[model samples]
Target: MSHHLASLMVAGGLDALTYSSLAFLIASGLTVVFGMLGFLNVAHTSFYMLAGYIGFSIASRTGSFWLALLLAPPVTVALGLAAERLLFRRLYAAGHTPQLLLTIGLAYVIAETTKMIWGDDSLALAPPTGLGGHVVILGATLPVYHLFVIVITMALVGLLALLIGWTRLGMVVRAAAIHPQMVDALGFKLSAVHTFVFLVGLYLAAVAGVVMAPMLGIYPGMADDALVQSFIVVVAGGLGSLPGAFVVAGLLGLVQGFGSVFLSDYALYFPFVVLAGVLLVRPLGLFGRGGA
Candidate 1:
């Protein structure tokens, strides 16, 4: 193969990795919240978009990318927690239709708020100091920030696995997801668990937003796009399965990246195509519970 062609493929693969990784980070929170509570949060991506805009605003004001990264996700998490407490708490058992509509309304409110704050124009965020350059990996020159994103995301996933798999908190969250009544009977506060887990999920969304801000920028329409992509990931991977989301999001991300490279005009359809195929075969999703 020509050197140029090989370089193109490598770049495409990296792009795919980047997209898949970010998609997982963003979608996992929604998946977990649904898995445990069986309530889909349509406003989740609003948190992601808010994080990006917040990060950009801070970065632009202070001229410090590190500060933005450090500050944005926490702020978004706090906002999400507030929304959960004041708004979502009232709708936990209201069925999917009402929750969906209300969250959509909430998302709309958030989008308008962002427009009022940041204007309608997209805003750029520079990468942090050490990540402002490229690095050679496997004979390919790649953006250091991209590599940093991939590595940090891997660690994030690992930490998540440990939290959910090895810790008491994870056990409680999983048990609650599977059987809230049983956990309640066992003397645990189901509401507290739900609130805590929801915050964790929103925090993950914010992390994804902050991490991707440099590449994606802050824009008015980002919330809508992110919502679509995250929903696809959650549904395709299975409603409540983080591992399933990781695998499916990775594959779909690759499909999107390579499709855009090899078949640019068709790239936009890849996500829906994958989603349709997944639903046609396994309506419950790849790892979704039969009860779910």
Candidate 2:
């Protein structure tokens, strides 16, 4: 292996773009629920972690990453809907503190349940047939899977932007976020909208885990790592701003990716440094209306 500083930096940039996309997928769910629903659900990352494990299992048993990718999101979405009816619905009026506690406890439960099912070992899956290769970029080797992840996530961003920005359903979602009571008073069932949004969030998390399962591996501790990233993205992007989530995700991804290559010894701390700097410069985050 030879060191090429410029090629290394480009590699880092590709890594950043891929990572930021995955983070955005996971964090978007958290931001949507927190920003639009006005309640913090810390257990969201559990869905992401669980999806990776589940998708891995499916791929292992069936030898088909395609099936795993298709099946995982719906399964996770179903679980989210169940949580809404059986657990989260009760917490709607309990405010953030109780919601936080309940979700924290739920996160533990999900983690433990995952342990019982998957054991404590970390698991990896092979990328889908077409994605398992390498591509050359700027005199450096880039994983084809990384570029694939970026394209899929970008497609998702476009789909979400269109759905939330133009559709009637999106109008209802925005209305619910801004004024739930008014939406309910206007003859639309707000609970359904809430359930839909929550499921969308969970689905997104599952999709992220499924797509990145090969890169990130599967383990019980994955949820905690994801939660930390989610918190940063949510805080940095501003609460309730999906567009902000996209920007912040990309920013943090680049910061961490390049920071690791340039400051390898301090790579672990670089992300937090970026977060702190962003906070100091604008406590409200880049697009947030106010600090959390």
Candidate 3:
């Protein structure tokens, strides 16, 4: 390829990776909750948006991005835990419709409350010190913060793999995902496991929100866009498959990044098209199985 073409390709590739990283972070939680708990949380992205606003507030007050990073996720987790304990716990046996409706209502509440508190204007959160510069990659200038996001995502992926593959909690979670009754019969606390998994999912979303705030900005309807993209990733990857979500997120990122350049007018529909194509070929998704 010519130098210009090569640079464009490199830039697009980097953009794709960054997008994939963010999607994975957001979708992994959604997948995990669905896989393990069988509960669909339509309000998950609202938690993400809420955490971003909280992080912004914390950073603004403390003048410490590090502090916001440290604290915002826990606050998100607290709210998630409250929702699980107070609302979701009572509805586990009520089926999907009620849960879906409840979550939708929760999303609206969060959106309106956020607007009331923070106003409707978009807010910017700067990257941490030393991450605001540009770096040259194959003659392509890229934001250092984008690279940081990619690296952090990779680290979190490894951490998740280790958490889900090797530990005792992981074993119990895996068992519960497939057969909660059997796990419960074996003396594991299903309720506790469900709560933990739900909180973990929220924690992941909060991390993505805080980390991605610099790139995406905090806005009133930010959660809507994220929710749409995340739902696409989850459904396209398979309802409850983390590995599938990761792969699909990468595929989606590439489609979006390049599509925006080459098919600007139609780029908005590209993800839905990819989702449709994937479902048409493999109804169960790329890596989906009968259970978690």
- In terms of lDDT, the best-performing candidate is 3
TM-score per candidate, chains pooled: 0.94, 0.95, 0.95
- Model 2 vs. true fold: TM: 0.95
lDDT score at residue 56, model 1, on the 0-100 scale: 85
Candidate 3's TM-score: 0.95
lDDT of each: 0.87, 0.87, 0.88
lDDT of 2: 0.87
Model 3 clash tally? 0
The parts of candidate 3 lying over 4 Å away from their true place are: 289-292
Clashes of each: 1, 0, 0
Task: Give Cα distance to truth, residue 4, candidate 2, Å.
Answer: 3.9
